[model samples]
Target: MQRLPSDPFTSPLWHFVAVLGINGETGQLRPAHHFTGILAGLIYTARAVVAEAALPSQDRAAMADLPERLAAIRKAWLCKSSYAPMGYVLNLLLYGKKIAFETGSRLAVVWNRDGTLLYFQGRPLAMETIRQLIASMTADAEDLLWDGLLFRPRKAEAEAEAGSSSGRRKGLGLLEREGRFLIPLATIRDDLTQTQRGQSFLHTNGLLGKEKEML
Candidate 1:
Protein backbone atom coordinates (compact mmCIF):
# COMPACT_ATOMS: atom_id res chain seq x y z
CA MET A 1 0.00 0.00 0.00
CA GLN A 2 1.18 3.49 -0.80
CA ARG A 3 2.02 5.37 2.35
CA LEU A 4 0.11 8.57 3.06
CA PRO A 5 1.84 11.68 4.29
CA SER A 6 1.55 12.35 8.00
CA ASP A 7 -0.87 15.05 9.00
CA PRO A 8 0.42 16.90 12.01
CA PHE A 9 -2.79 18.80 12.48
CA THR A 10 -4.90 15.65 12.59
CA SER A 11 -3.01 14.12 15.47
CA PRO A 12 -4.98 13.70 18.66
CA LEU A 13 -2.40 15.70 20.56
CA TRP A 14 -3.10 18.68 18.35
CA HIS A 15 -6.65 18.87 19.63
CA PHE A 16 -7.69 20.86 22.70
CA VAL A 17 -5.57 23.86 21.82
CA ALA A 18 -6.62 27.47 22.32
CA VAL A 19 -5.77 30.44 20.17
CA LEU A 20 -4.08 33.41 21.80
CA GLY A 21 -4.24 36.97 20.59
CA ILE A 22 -1.42 39.53 20.59
CA ASN A 23 -2.75 40.80 23.94
CA GLY A 24 -2.42 37.27 25.33
CA GLU A 25 -6.14 36.72 25.43
CA THR A 26 -7.29 33.11 25.04
CA GLY A 27 -10.07 32.19 22.67
CA GLN A 28 -10.90 30.00 19.72
CA LEU A 29 -8.73 30.85 16.77
CA ARG A 30 -10.62 33.09 14.44
CA PRO A 31 -11.26 32.01 10.91
CA ALA A 32 -8.36 32.87 8.63
CA HIS A 33 -10.22 35.86 7.27
CA HIS A 34 -10.16 37.69 10.58
CA PHE A 35 -6.95 36.16 11.89
CA THR A 36 -4.76 37.29 8.99
CA GLY A 37 -4.95 40.93 10.03
CA ILE A 38 -3.88 40.13 13.57
CA LEU A 39 -0.94 38.12 12.31
CA ALA A 40 0.02 40.79 9.81
CA GLY A 41 -0.21 43.50 12.42
CA LEU A 42 2.00 41.68 14.85
CA ILE A 43 4.63 40.66 12.29
CA TYR A 44 4.59 44.18 10.92
CA THR A 45 4.97 45.74 14.34
CA ALA A 46 7.86 43.50 15.22
CA ARG A 47 9.44 44.33 11.90
CA ALA A 48 9.08 48.05 12.41
CA VAL A 49 10.78 47.85 15.76
CA VAL A 50 13.65 45.84 14.39
CA ALA A 51 14.27 48.07 11.37
CA GLU A 52 13.55 51.51 12.79
CA ALA A 53 16.39 54.00 12.44
CA ALA A 54 17.26 57.70 12.83
CA LEU A 55 14.87 58.06 15.77
CA PRO A 56 15.87 59.76 18.99
CA SER A 57 18.15 57.75 21.23
CA GLN A 58 15.28 57.34 23.64
CA ASP A 59 13.12 55.84 20.96
CA ARG A 60 15.94 53.60 19.84
CA ALA A 61 16.48 52.49 23.41
CA ALA A 62 12.84 51.67 23.79
CA MET A 63 12.96 49.47 20.68
CA ALA A 64 15.98 47.71 22.11
CA ASP A 65 13.85 46.81 25.13
CA LEU A 66 11.09 45.17 23.08
CA PRO A 67 11.80 41.57 24.03
CA GLU A 68 11.82 42.33 27.73
CA ARG A 69 8.77 44.50 27.34
CA LEU A 70 6.92 41.72 25.55
CA ALA A 71 7.85 39.27 28.27
CA ALA A 72 6.66 41.62 30.97
CA ILE A 73 3.47 42.33 29.07
CA ARG A 74 2.83 38.62 28.65
CA LYS A 75 3.41 37.95 32.32
CA ALA A 76 1.24 40.79 33.54
CA TRP A 77 -1.67 40.15 31.20
CA LEU A 78 -1.61 36.38 30.87
CA CYS A 79 -0.68 35.28 34.36
CA LYS A 80 -3.85 33.25 34.72
CA SER A 81 -3.50 31.02 31.68
CA SER A 82 -1.28 29.49 29.06
CA TYR A 83 -0.63 31.69 26.04
CA ALA A 84 1.53 32.07 22.98
CA PRO A 85 2.18 34.83 20.47
CA MET A 86 1.19 34.79 16.84
CA GLY A 87 4.83 34.22 15.96
CA TYR A 88 4.54 30.82 17.61
CA VAL A 89 1.88 29.96 15.08
CA LEU A 90 4.08 31.07 12.22
CA ASN A 91 6.97 29.04 13.56
CA LEU A 92 4.79 25.98 13.86
CA LEU A 93 3.57 26.29 10.31
CA LEU A 94 7.03 26.74 8.90
CA TYR A 95 8.93 24.21 11.00
CA GLY A 96 6.47 21.84 12.63
CA LYS A 97 8.62 18.72 12.49
CA LYS A 98 11.59 20.49 13.98
CA ILE A 99 9.60 21.82 16.94
CA ALA A 100 7.27 18.95 17.69
CA PHE A 101 8.10 16.11 20.08
CA GLU A 102 6.44 13.00 21.46
CA THR A 103 4.49 14.91 24.09
CA GLY A 104 3.34 18.04 22.29
CA SER A 105 4.50 20.99 20.22
CA ARG A 106 5.77 24.23 21.75
CA LEU A 107 3.96 26.06 19.01
CA ALA A 108 0.72 25.17 20.78
CA VAL A 109 1.67 26.95 24.02
CA VAL A 110 2.12 24.97 27.26
CA TRP A 111 2.38 26.37 30.73
CA ASN A 112 4.58 25.07 33.53
CA ARG A 113 3.08 22.77 36.12
CA ASP A 114 2.80 25.66 38.58
CA GLY A 115 1.76 28.12 35.87
CA THR A 116 4.78 30.28 36.48
CA LEU A 117 5.90 30.62 32.88
CA LEU A 118 5.18 29.37 29.42
CA TYR A 119 7.66 26.71 28.34
CA PHE A 120 8.54 24.75 25.25
CA GLN A 121 11.25 22.21 24.53
CA GLY A 122 12.70 21.80 21.08
CA ARG A 123 15.82 20.49 19.42
CA PRO A 124 18.56 22.80 18.26
CA LEU A 125 17.25 22.57 14.73
CA ALA A 126 13.84 23.79 15.85
CA MET A 127 15.38 26.60 17.81
CA GLU A 128 17.41 27.71 14.83
CA THR A 129 14.39 27.51 12.59
CA ILE A 130 12.41 29.69 14.93
CA ARG A 131 15.21 32.23 15.13
CA GLN A 132 15.51 32.43 11.37
CA LEU A 133 11.75 32.64 10.97
CA ILE A 134 11.57 35.60 13.31
CA ALA A 135 14.33 37.33 11.38
CA SER A 136 12.70 36.77 8.02
CA MET A 137 9.23 37.76 9.18
CA THR A 138 10.56 40.86 10.84
CA ALA A 139 12.29 41.84 7.62
CA ASP A 140 9.13 41.35 5.60
CA ALA A 141 7.11 43.21 8.17
CA GLU A 142 9.57 46.09 8.12
CA ASP A 143 8.90 46.56 4.45
CA LEU A 144 5.18 46.65 5.13
CA LEU A 145 5.67 49.06 7.98
CA TRP A 146 7.65 51.38 5.74
CA ASP A 147 4.84 51.20 3.20
CA GLY A 148 2.34 52.19 5.91
CA LEU A 149 0.25 49.10 5.33
CA LEU A 150 0.75 47.89 8.89
CA PHE A 151 0.90 51.11 10.95
CA ARG A 152 -0.68 54.51 10.46
CA PRO A 153 2.18 56.57 9.03
CA ARG A 154 1.93 57.04 5.32
CA LYS A 155 4.82 56.14 3.03
CA ALA A 156 5.38 59.82 2.30
CA GLU A 157 5.43 60.66 6.00
CA ALA A 158 7.85 57.85 6.76
CA GLU A 159 10.17 59.02 4.01
CA ALA A 160 9.96 62.64 5.16
CA GLU A 161 10.46 61.71 8.80
CA ALA A 162 13.33 59.44 7.94
CA GLY A 163 15.43 62.58 7.61
CA SER A 164 13.96 64.40 10.61
CA SER A 165 15.43 64.51 14.13
CA SER A 166 12.14 64.40 15.99
CA GLY A 167 10.97 60.96 17.08
CA ARG A 168 7.49 62.13 17.94
CA ARG A 169 5.69 60.58 15.02
CA LYS A 170 2.50 58.70 15.84
CA GLY A 171 2.42 54.99 15.00
CA LEU A 172 6.20 54.94 15.13
CA GLY A 173 5.96 52.77 18.19
CA LEU A 174 3.67 49.95 19.05
CA LEU A 175 0.02 50.55 19.55
CA GLU A 176 -0.49 53.10 22.28
CA ARG A 177 -3.61 54.88 23.43
CA GLU A 178 -4.10 56.94 26.59
CA GLY A 179 -0.60 56.18 27.87
CA ARG A 180 -1.03 52.42 27.42
CA PHE A 181 0.19 50.01 24.77
CA LEU A 182 -2.98 48.01 24.89
CA ILE A 183 -4.73 48.59 21.56
CA PRO A 184 -8.45 49.08 21.65
CA LEU A 185 -10.44 46.33 19.96
CA ALA A 186 -12.15 48.96 17.89
CA THR A 187 -9.02 49.20 15.79
CA ILE A 188 -9.40 45.62 14.72
CA ARG A 189 -11.96 44.66 12.13
CA ASP A 190 -13.86 41.40 12.35
CA ASP A 191 -14.25 40.78 8.66
CA LEU A 192 -14.72 37.04 9.03
CA THR A 193 -18.24 35.67 9.29
CA GLN A 194 -21.30 37.50 8.06
CA THR A 195 -22.45 38.16 11.60
CA GLN A 196 -19.06 39.59 12.55
CA ARG A 197 -18.48 41.71 9.46
CA GLY A 198 -20.02 44.97 10.62
CA GLN A 199 -20.01 44.29 14.35
CA SER A 200 -16.34 44.82 15.12
CA PHE A 201 -15.66 45.80 18.71
CA LEU A 202 -14.60 49.21 17.43
CA HIS A 203 -17.70 49.52 15.31
CA THR A 204 -19.94 48.59 18.19
CA ASN A 205 -18.19 51.20 20.28
CA GLY A 206 -18.59 53.87 17.59
CA LEU A 207 -14.86 53.87 16.90
CA LEU A 208 -15.16 52.45 13.41
CA GLY A 209 -13.94 54.60 10.50
CA LYS A 210 -11.34 56.08 12.82
CA GLU A 211 -8.46 54.75 10.78
CA LYS A 212 -9.63 56.56 7.67
CA GLU A 213 -10.14 59.69 9.70
CA MET A 214 -6.55 59.47 10.85
CA LEU A 215 -5.41 59.29 7.27
Candidate 2:
Protein backbone atom coordinates (compact mmCIF):
# COMPACT_ATOMS: atom_id res chain seq x y z
CA MET A 1 0.00 0.00 0.00
CA GLN A 2 1.13 3.54 -0.69
CA ARG A 3 2.17 5.42 2.39
CA LEU A 4 -0.23 8.20 3.33
CA PRO A 5 1.57 11.23 4.75
CA SER A 6 -1.45 12.41 6.74
CA ASP A 7 -4.79 11.15 7.98
CA PRO A 8 -7.82 11.32 5.71
CA PHE A 9 -10.36 10.67 8.43
CA THR A 10 -13.36 12.93 8.06
CA SER A 11 -15.68 11.20 10.49
CA PRO A 12 -15.41 10.83 14.27
CA LEU A 13 -12.06 9.22 15.02
CA TRP A 14 -12.76 6.43 17.49
CA HIS A 15 -15.26 5.21 20.06
CA PHE A 16 -14.40 5.76 23.70
CA VAL A 17 -14.40 2.13 24.76
CA ALA A 18 -12.56 1.78 28.06
CA VAL A 19 -14.08 3.49 31.08
CA LEU A 20 -11.68 5.95 32.64
CA GLY A 21 -11.62 7.23 36.26
CA ILE A 22 -12.68 3.69 37.22
CA ASN A 23 -9.10 3.65 38.40
CA GLY A 24 -7.79 7.25 38.33
CA GLU A 25 -6.85 8.47 34.85
CA THR A 26 -9.72 10.06 33.04
CA GLY A 27 -11.39 9.54 29.65
CA GLN A 28 -11.25 6.50 27.37
CA LEU A 29 -7.59 6.05 26.47
CA ARG A 30 -5.24 3.49 25.05
CA PRO A 31 -2.90 1.68 27.46
CA ALA A 32 0.10 0.26 25.64
CA HIS A 33 2.76 -1.67 27.54
CA HIS A 34 5.74 0.47 28.46
CA PHE A 35 8.16 -1.85 26.68
CA THR A 36 6.12 -1.58 23.50
CA GLY A 37 6.30 2.19 23.83
CA ILE A 38 10.08 2.00 23.97
CA LEU A 39 10.16 -0.31 21.00
CA ALA A 40 8.07 2.13 19.01
CA GLY A 41 10.59 4.88 19.58
CA LEU A 42 13.52 2.56 18.97
CA ILE A 43 12.16 1.38 15.64
CA TYR A 44 11.45 4.93 14.58
CA THR A 45 14.94 6.07 15.47
CA ALA A 46 16.60 2.95 14.13
CA ARG A 47 14.85 3.13 10.79
CA ALA A 48 16.46 6.53 10.30
CA VAL A 49 19.85 5.55 11.72
CA VAL A 50 19.84 2.46 9.58
CA ALA A 51 18.92 4.43 6.48
CA GLU A 52 22.03 6.51 7.07
CA ALA A 53 23.99 3.32 7.90
CA ALA A 54 24.74 4.89 11.26
CA LEU A 55 23.15 2.25 13.50
CA PRO A 56 25.68 0.36 15.57
CA SER A 57 26.56 -3.10 14.34
CA GLN A 58 25.36 -4.86 17.48
CA ASP A 59 22.00 -3.07 17.54
CA ARG A 60 21.59 -3.66 13.81
CA ALA A 61 21.86 -7.41 14.32
CA ALA A 62 19.36 -7.27 17.18
CA MET A 63 16.83 -5.62 14.91
CA ALA A 64 17.34 -8.12 12.08
CA ASP A 65 14.00 -9.70 12.61
CA LEU A 66 11.67 -6.81 13.34
CA PRO A 67 8.27 -7.79 14.72
CA GLU A 68 6.18 -7.78 11.55
CA ARG A 69 2.87 -6.77 13.12
CA LEU A 70 4.46 -4.24 15.41
CA ALA A 71 6.43 -2.64 12.58
CA ALA A 72 3.32 -2.54 10.40
CA ILE A 73 1.28 -0.87 13.12
CA ARG A 74 4.05 1.63 13.73
CA LYS A 75 4.13 2.55 10.06
CA ALA A 76 0.39 3.08 10.07
CA TRP A 77 0.68 5.25 13.16
CA LEU A 78 3.65 7.30 12.01
CA CYS A 79 1.93 7.99 8.75
CA LYS A 80 -1.40 8.69 10.46
CA SER A 81 -3.20 6.33 8.13
CA SER A 82 -6.94 6.63 8.23
CA TYR A 83 -7.27 3.15 6.73
CA ALA A 84 -5.50 1.71 9.74
CA PRO A 85 -7.50 2.92 12.70
CA MET A 86 -5.11 3.47 15.62
CA GLY A 87 -7.67 2.50 18.22
CA TYR A 88 -7.77 -0.99 16.69
CA VAL A 89 -4.01 -0.94 16.17
CA LEU A 90 -3.28 -0.17 19.82
CA ASN A 91 -5.27 -3.27 20.83
CA LEU A 92 -3.27 -5.26 18.30
CA LEU A 93 0.15 -4.00 19.43
CA LEU A 94 0.09 -4.30 23.25
CA TYR A 95 2.25 -7.35 24.12
CA GLY A 96 0.18 -7.98 27.21
CA LYS A 97 -0.43 -11.74 27.38
CA LYS A 98 3.23 -12.64 26.96
CA ILE A 99 3.64 -10.88 30.27
CA ALA A 100 0.25 -11.98 31.55
CA PHE A 101 1.60 -13.76 34.60
CA GLU A 102 2.56 -10.30 35.78
CA THR A 103 -0.93 -9.05 34.99
CA GLY A 104 -2.48 -7.73 38.17
CA SER A 105 -3.55 -4.47 39.73
CA ARG A 106 0.13 -3.80 40.34
CA LEU A 107 0.88 -4.25 36.67
CA ALA A 108 -1.80 -1.84 35.54
CA VAL A 109 -0.51 1.75 35.47
CA VAL A 110 -2.10 5.14 34.83
CA TRP A 111 -1.16 8.78 34.12
CA ASN A 112 -2.62 12.27 34.27
CA ARG A 113 -3.21 15.01 31.67
CA ASP A 114 0.17 16.71 31.70
CA GLY A 115 2.10 13.46 32.25
CA THR A 116 3.49 14.73 35.55
CA LEU A 117 1.86 12.57 38.19
CA LEU A 118 2.23 8.89 37.41
CA TYR A 119 1.22 5.64 39.11
CA PHE A 120 2.57 2.20 38.44
CA GLN A 121 0.84 -0.97 39.55
CA GLY A 122 -1.30 1.59 41.38
CA ARG A 123 1.50 3.64 42.99
CA PRO A 124 4.29 6.03 42.16
CA LEU A 125 7.45 4.38 40.94
CA ALA A 126 10.20 3.93 43.51
CA MET A 127 12.99 6.51 43.56
CA GLU A 128 15.53 4.02 42.18
CA THR A 129 13.34 3.14 39.18
CA ILE A 130 12.78 6.80 38.39
CA ARG A 131 16.51 7.41 38.68
CA GLN A 132 17.20 4.48 36.41
CA LEU A 133 14.73 5.70 33.81
CA ILE A 134 16.31 9.14 33.92
CA ALA A 135 19.75 7.63 33.59
CA SER A 136 18.65 5.56 30.62
CA MET A 137 17.20 8.58 28.83
CA THR A 138 20.19 10.88 29.27
CA ALA A 139 23.92 10.83 29.85
CA ASP A 140 23.91 13.81 32.24
CA ALA A 141 21.22 12.23 34.37
CA GLU A 142 23.34 12.94 37.45
CA ASP A 143 22.81 16.66 36.87
CA LEU A 144 19.06 16.15 36.95
CA LEU A 145 16.81 16.46 39.95
CA TRP A 146 13.27 15.34 40.60
CA ASP A 147 10.78 17.42 42.56
CA GLY A 148 7.85 15.07 43.15
CA LEU A 149 6.49 15.45 39.60
CA LEU A 150 9.01 15.47 36.76
CA PHE A 151 12.78 15.76 36.42
CA ARG A 152 14.58 18.92 35.38
CA PRO A 153 18.20 19.76 34.70
CA ARG A 154 20.01 21.51 37.52
CA LYS A 155 20.90 25.15 37.10
CA ALA A 156 24.66 25.18 37.07
CA GLU A 157 26.60 28.30 38.10
CA ALA A 158 28.21 28.57 34.67
CA GLU A 159 25.73 29.50 31.91
CA ALA A 160 27.30 27.16 29.33
CA GLU A 161 27.46 24.26 31.76
CA ALA A 162 23.89 24.82 32.86
CA GLY A 163 22.60 24.47 29.30
CA SER A 164 24.35 21.15 28.73
CA SER A 165 22.60 18.34 26.88
CA SER A 166 21.00 17.14 30.10
CA GLY A 167 17.59 17.19 28.54
CA ARG A 168 18.69 15.19 25.52
CA ARG A 169 17.23 11.74 25.08
CA LYS A 170 20.16 9.38 24.68
CA GLY A 171 17.66 6.68 23.93
CA LEU A 172 14.06 5.64 24.35
CA GLY A 173 12.77 5.68 27.94
CA LEU A 174 12.39 2.55 30.04
CA LEU A 175 9.25 3.31 32.05
CA GLU A 176 7.07 6.28 31.20
CA ARG A 177 3.33 6.89 31.08
CA GLU A 178 3.09 9.51 28.32
CA GLY A 179 -0.12 10.08 26.40
CA ARG A 180 -2.51 12.85 25.56
CA PHE A 181 -5.73 14.00 27.15
CA LEU A 182 -7.93 12.95 24.28
CA ILE A 183 -11.53 13.82 23.60
CA PRO A 184 -13.07 10.72 22.12
CA LEU A 185 -15.26 10.81 19.03
CA ALA A 186 -18.20 9.59 21.02
CA THR A 187 -19.33 8.87 24.56
CA ILE A 188 -19.87 5.18 23.96
CA ARG A 189 -18.83 1.98 25.70
CA ASP A 190 -21.06 -0.52 23.93
CA ASP A 191 -18.03 -2.00 22.15
CA LEU A 192 -16.57 -2.83 25.57
CA THR A 193 -19.87 -3.48 27.40
CA GLN A 194 -20.92 -5.99 24.77
CA THR A 195 -18.28 -8.68 25.34
CA GLN A 196 -15.76 -10.72 27.32
CA ARG A 197 -14.32 -12.21 24.16
CA GLY A 198 -12.36 -9.00 23.96
CA GLN A 199 -11.34 -9.60 27.57
CA SER A 200 -10.13 -13.04 26.50
CA PHE A 201 -7.98 -11.34 23.88
CA LEU A 202 -6.55 -9.22 26.68
CA HIS A 203 -5.71 -12.33 28.73
CA THR A 204 -4.39 -14.39 25.85
CA ASN A 205 -2.56 -11.43 24.40
CA GLY A 206 -2.32 -9.31 27.59
CA LEU A 207 -1.82 -6.05 25.75
CA LEU A 208 -1.77 -2.82 24.87
CA GLY A 209 -2.32 4.72 21.78
CA LYS A 210 -2.99 8.52 18.48
CA GLU A 211 -3.94 11.73 16.56
CA LYS A 212 -4.19 14.35 13.75
CA GLU A 213 -6.85 15.04 11.20
CA MET A 214 -9.18 17.79 10.10
CA LEU A 215 -10.80 19.33 7.01
Please give, for residues 21-71, the per-residue lDDT of candidate 2 as tens digits.
Answer: 133434334343443443354445645643434434567566755556446
Q: Provide the TM-score for each candidate, comma-separated.
A: 0.20, 0.18
Instruction: Please list the residue runs of candidate 1 whose C-alpha ends up more than 4 Å from where it truly belongs after superposition.
Output: 1-123, 126-132, 135-139, 145-209
Give the C-alpha miss distance for residue 189 in model 2, angstroms: 48
Off by over 4 Å in 2: 1-32, 54-124, 128-215
* Per-candidate local distance difference test: 0.41, 0.40
lDDT of 1 by residue, 75-109 (tens): 43222232333234344433433333232422535
Residue pairs that clash (backbone atoms under 3 angstroms), model 1? 186-202
Backbone clashes for every candidate come to: 1, 6
By summed lDDT, which 10 consecutive residues of candidate 1 come out lowest?
13-22
